[model samples]
Target chain A: MQRALTLAALALAIAFPMAAVPLDLDFYIGFASRVMIYAIAATSLNLILGYGGMVSFGHAAFFGTGAYVVAIAMTHGIDSLWVSWPLAMLVSGIVALGIGAISLRTRGVYFIMITLAFAQMMFFVFIGLKAYGGEEGLNMPHRSVIGLGLNLKNDATFYYVVLTVLVATLYLLRRLIDARFGRVVEAIRENEARMETIGFSTYRYKLTCFVIAGMVCGLAGALIANQTRYVNPNLMHWIVSGDMMIMIILGGLGYRFGGVLGAIVMLVLDEAISPYTTYSKIVIGFVLLAVVLFAPRGLAGLFDRKRVRAGGGHG
Target chain B: MNSATRMTEPVLEVRALCKRFGGLVATDQVSLDVRPGEVHALIGPNGAGKTTLVHQLSGTLPPDSGSILFRGDDVTHLAANARVLRGLVRSYQITSIFRQHSVLDNVALAVQARSGSSFRFWRPVRDESALFDEARAVLARVGLADRADVLAANLAHGEQRQLEVGLAVATRPAMLLLDEPMAGMGPEESERLIPLIDGLRKDVSILLIEHDMDAVFRLADRISVLVSGRVIATGTPDDIRANADVKRAYLGDELEAASGGEA
Candidate 1:
């Protein structure tokens, strides 16, 4: 069921290929790419929080780590996309391991608070870097190139790269969620005590999941840095974590495709509402409040009974 | 089917087991032995500490005192999960299970745990044919093969109890702890359950705790009666039923019929 959903989403992505001639099409395509990136990050959280029953509030550390990797590598007279991309992923994975080792010891609300503290510490360090544009941020002199055949600076080329990577990630993540490891995580979510009696060291499983989530979030961070062509301490702020949570909530926390739909809806609303009034933050806050209060399960619950419709099946 | 063919070495031996809760002594100096493929029943009234002994044997709770030997190794302070690896699986009395998971997934998870390296991420266990075969076989054993895809939360209470035992059996443990598995069941449910449990004794050593005296006497080849944190008697069902102290502690008037008394 999850596989079919990923394939359908992939088909939609390929058939609509966003880099074509229509100017407005480019805007929607760009909107979708951003949405896909957020969905990727949010989905990683769902893997741990929703499935593994872990609630982490400091995921921005991995995000920032990824961004820093790309930014730092690019500024050092190196514009090699091939090198920086994987390097960024590896760095994020390491950061996740370091943070997860300590933070996973704390359970429930304590886990959230500890994760938040780690993220803040990292954010403050980034802000303190006087050479790397400090608190303001840094503009990339050039986009990283894979050399030989690829010209990444072209908006069309980069958009498709982001799109392709997003689809592949969704495929891998969907498979991971349905696997035996995924079952254990979900089982842990359902009943850790019962799991223990059956002979599973739940802590090992949780840490493994925590690292996977962090590594994936790191990949999303790299994509975001590319889209903006900039890096800043703001990327690692707790508010960003809050934004990811909001996206997941609006989509319905555990609804697979609903998470993607939520990111699209939120970004589109932000864009639309900002034009009507300058107080977009206030409007976004009100919209979020309404979604939480009136739509407890978010937009997906609006179609609670209408599950398995024509739009997509088994997502 | 016979106890003589069971493990030549005892699967578990409790040496002076004791569990204390501040002012209360839950399980006091209880020593017992369970051999593989044999049925050893632990029977007592409510608060006789049968459940406490089960907890300590399963390693969910470390004994406040005394060592537990399983398969010739001392597993006194081992974690609940570690004992499970050594083939000591236990089912809860409360019918606890992962309700949100499909019946297949629940059993598959236990299979995965027993399969070793439950952290394997590259391949899906559901795709593994061996896992499917094992889950189906265990579910079939509990007479739940038809409901493999059903959500456990939606199952009837008795069906849930069956699945609970089915889950323990899936792990292929050397010894099984069935803790008051028939509690709150109607007569028909009990009729179905006894055969399910009886079938299990053929494969594994079972230590069953039950409040139902009839079921205890019927299933247990050897019965141990516990009272006020101590084992008052350890003998065959006929011997336990005839003991004067065991009569006063539990069964009371019911003991007379089991003893074949004229009164």
Candidate 2:
């Protein structure tokens, strides 16, 4: 019964963009694409924070870098996404490797602070690069062409592309969460010292998780750059990182659709409430507090009927 | 498995190990060796630095000065996980199994540690029948096969202790450092664990740090008594029973009480 509901939801997501195109609901379509991009970013953060137990506060470093990578490549006449998108992922991955190597050595709050420091450092580095428009931000010449005969310039087409990416990302992440790697990562979260005594080099596993999250978030950054046609140092700001964290918590930490649900709700609330009130944040804050006080597991956790049992499936 | 060939040399050798915390000496010039296929028991009173010595041996705590040789390789500098990979595994005095995991998963993780690289990111671990099969075999060995699907935290204290030993044993250790595996157990629970350790002697050598004199005498091939962070005596059970130094330092009336209770 739940499976049918989930499939129906997916079907709605696919058909909604097509229906919105004819109904002149272009603004909603663009908003939906933005939500998907945020969903990808939040889900990537979940891999490290929720699963691996690494509370990184500098995820924006990767997200901004991915956006910058695409914008910079387009300025250099690299208009094909085939080259720019992978470049964004690769660059973010390498950056994550370097940051993770240093940051993973410290645990708990120190880990969080160190990651934040690295991200702020990246933010400043980009700000210093006057050639890339510095604090003013850079504008893309045009959205990178897919060359597959689809018009990325169309809002509906871009929404479909983002939905496809989100679905693929979710599928791959699900596989990863159920795999041996995920089990080890989760075990490390439960008891790291035990993992070491059990012969696991836990540092390496954590570093890998950090890199994967960074790479995926980078993909989101690339899509967002295409969607907005703008890249800015503010994308790497600590506020962005905090926002992504909020989305994960709002959706439900460790659940597969936690990030996606959180992104949709958060974005929808912002869109609907901001027009009427300047205190929209205060309203959202109360909602978040209520969720924490009542639900404790976020929005996605509400659908779970049975209490988690021993040897049960994980998200 | 080839216990005969390795019997000529000590499987583990600790030399002049010392650890000092400021003015206090926790472990002073401690030294011991466990021969292949033998269960060497280290007995001591409270604050005798038995746990400190175990920490140093297992690479959790670095001894201020010591040389530890495992399988003839100097592993004093190796990390805990490195030592584990070399088949030097330890169970905690305070039962440290993964509390959130299932009883089967707790052992399966240990088996997975020893089997292959945990960097495998594609296939689900549930689909790995061989890993689960080996884990079940380990659970059966530790007498937890019936409770394999139960959450580890839900187990009774005695059963959790069994799972603790089960975790170490599943790692396929060459030498097991069991730090009071039967701690906080009733007499009946302790009675059940005696044969479990006894059964492991065929394939694995054991360095047991236990306070239970009955368990020590029954399981140990040789006994070393530690008092005031020093080895007072090292000999066979009967030999140590006769040693006056062992009597005065740690045992005193405890051995008599153990024998009396056993009878």
Candidate 3:
């Protein structure tokens, strides 16, 4: 049934160019593209935080490195999409690997603080970079394009591409989590010591997950760069890391579909609340706190048939 | 006893291992040997340092001073997990398992660890026939093949203990360190566990730590007694039973009262 739903979504996405929703307005497409990008980032964070039991708060460093990869490559006059996007991913993966190797050496509150510190350090490096826009930011002359004849400058065209990538990425993530690797990560989450005593090397597995997450989040950063045509130190801010954490918690920690719903709900909330008053921050904050306290399992807990049946048929 | 190289040599040899926590000495100069496929029981009273010895042998704690040789390799300083990978598996006194997962998933993880390469990110655990087959076989061996789909946390305490043993066995390790498998069990459960543990002696070497004297006497080929961080005695169950100092340590009056009260 999930496969069919995914297939239907894919079919609709493929036919979307032909059956355009008619919301080609720059504002609507832009909002959607940004949400899709953030979805990628949130999904990656959830892989480690929710499933693997590694509460890393420095995911923004990788997110920013991804953005920097594109900005740095373009600043050097390398406009080729092929060259920039892959390098962006590689650099982010390497950074995550290095940071994860060190930060994951500790556990509990120490783990969270270590990850946050590493991300803050990265943020500072970007602030210190007078060569790239320093405190302001950097902008790309043109968006990335495939070698094909299609122009990526078209807002509608790029929005659809972002959507396709989001869907495919989610599909790949689902596959990865259901595999033997996923089982082991869940085992670690459930009982790290038990897994270790059974002859499994846990640190290596966590590092591997950290790298995969970084690699995926980097791709999201590449998309974000193209969407805005800009890169800035703000991309690596502690607030951005907090945003990803909020998304994971609000959606549902361990639910595969929670990350996607989290991104969508957060985006929608931001868009809606900002118009009501300047007090939008108060409302978002309370809603987030409520979710963490009252509904920790999040939206997917409501949707899971197993959970529903087990939860006295509440669904 | 000098079957040095082949099957006769001990799989694990411990010598004068000591661990101290602040002013209290947890394990003091404990020494023992575990021959291959032999059930070696370490019996001691509360705070007698049996667990401290197990921790040192399992690599969870570093010995203040001493050495551990597993299969003739000096593994005294290896990390707990590294020691586990080297085939020293320990079962906790309080059953530590993945509570949310099905029993089959719990054991399958053990099999997956041994089969090498958990990097296959597309194959479902249930669909991995090789893992499922081995998991089922292990559950069967531990008398839990029927509860494969049941969540581990939801199991009765006895069944969870059985699964814990199954997990240690599924690793197919050269030695198992069982830390009081009968700790909280009722008589019916303890009765059930003894044969299962006795049956394990046919294949697996065990460093059995227990407070249940009868179970220890029934199951151990050889016995070591710990008294306040030190090995006070090492002998067969009969030798241990005949020792006057061992009786003094456990209290002869308490033993007589217990036997009188039970009868």
Question: Chain A TM-score per candidate?
Answer: 0.88, 0.96, 0.92
Query: Could you arrange the candidates by DockQ from highest to lowest?
Result: 3, 2, 1
Candidate 2 per-residue lDDT over residues A1-315, each given as its tens digit: 667977997899999988886898968999999999999999999999877778999999999999999999999999898999999999999999999999999988999999999999999998999999999899987898898888799888898889999998888898998999999998988889898999999999999999999999999999999999999999999999998998998998887888998888888998899999998888888888988888788887888766452431221
Q: Candidate 1 residues B103-210, lDDT tens each?
A: 887888888888857666668665788988888998998989999988777788888888889889988988999998898887688878898888988878999998
lDDT of each: 0.81, 0.91, 0.85
Model 2, range B20-70, lDDT digits (tens) per residue?
999999999989999998999999889999999999999999999989999
Could you give the interface RMSD of each candidate, to one decimal? 5.9, 4.3, 5.2
lDDT-superior candidate, 1 or 2: 2
lDDT of 1 by residue, A1-315 (tens): 556755786777775644344545665666666777887888777777755767788877888888888988888976687788888889988888888899988888999999999999999999999899899888887777767787877666666787777667667767777777877887787788888988898888888889888888898888888878899999999998877777777876556555566777778888888878888778778878899888876676675663322121110
Candidate 1, residue B246: lDDT: 81
User: Which parts of model 1 are misplaced by more than 4 Å?
Assistant: A1-21, A24-32, A278-282, A285-315, B1-6, B120-126, B253-263
Clashes of 3: 1
Score residue B182 of candidate 3 by CA lDDT: 90
**Candidate 3: segments with Cα more than 4 A from true spot:** A1-26, A307-315, B1-4, B251-254
| Local distance difference test, candidate 3 | 0.85
